[model samples]
Target: MDDELHRRLRIEQARALLDNADPRQAVMLACDLLMAGVNGDAVVALAAESARTLPAYDANRRLAAVIDELGLPELDLPTAVALIAADTCERILDCSIPAEVGTHRLYVVGYEGSPLDHLLPEVTALAAHLEDDLGGRADDDLRTRLGALARTILDRLKAENPA
Candidate 1:
């Protein structure tokens, strides 16, 4: 097969490994791709995509090493937003994290000039409300709202990049 075909196969293999939560194998395959001259950006992008598949906690632990090895500051903007949104949504929906924590995560995703920048105002307002409810009395309502916002953010991201 031609070199291009070979590279594509490697890329697909790496993707499959990551999708299956096999970060170790994915990282090894990514290294091979790098040695074979695959662009570092492409490798990073592929590895970062795993955040969408892996549970948030697991993705955070696993992807950290890959990010460090690749020497990137963080995943690209869109992926970072998606990961944060997904994580916050899951925690809120399950009532696993406090309203403050979910609010903080949403705040991070709505940073100035981020892909979710348009949500900055709303997120900031929600964060303040969450802070008021930090005592846990109003947690359920806040958590539900936060979860809905997170779901909206994730849906927007998916609609934008439908692949």
Candidate 2:
């Protein structure tokens, strides 16, 4: 599909989420709309035209700061997955790499489910944890390898420590 159609579909999806999702989910969707330059003001303007209070406005406002600080990529699918996994690993493993590099191999691994399924809570949590990697994106082959590696590592750790 074309860029305009894709963008419009995203907007429609966000709108549906705003109407039906819980606060946390709605906030994330709202942030996405804002980032896409989807006329957030117009979206919420009818309620209070002058104030321009978009749905989940407070959360989106906070997210704006996060985006400004971390910087989102033009194509964030693979980047988001790698970064999230890396960041999560960094936290869970007491990993030696910089806070930006989860478990060190996280950039070339798996964490995110799929871009097509990004609206899921798990995906969002992964992205947020990535607040800290992404020297590369996580493609399917890489994700598969990473998944097996992660399982092996987890099994070894469990066996060694019994925790």
**Predicted structure with the largest TM-score when compared to the true one:** 1
Residue-pair clashes per candidate:
0, 1
Worst 10 residues of 1 by lDDT: 12-21
lDDT by residue for model 2 over 58-93, one digit each (tens)? 434443433333343233444334333333443444
* RMSD of each predicted structure: 10.4, 15.5
Residue-level lDDT tens digits of model 1 in 16-49? 3333224554554455556666556646554555
Deviating ranges (above 4 Å) for candidate 1: 1-74, 133-137
Would you list the C-alpha lDDT of every candidate in the order shown?
0.57, 0.38
Clashing residue pairs found in predicted model 1: none
Candidate no. 2 TM-score: 0.24
Cand. 1 Cα-lDDT: 0.57
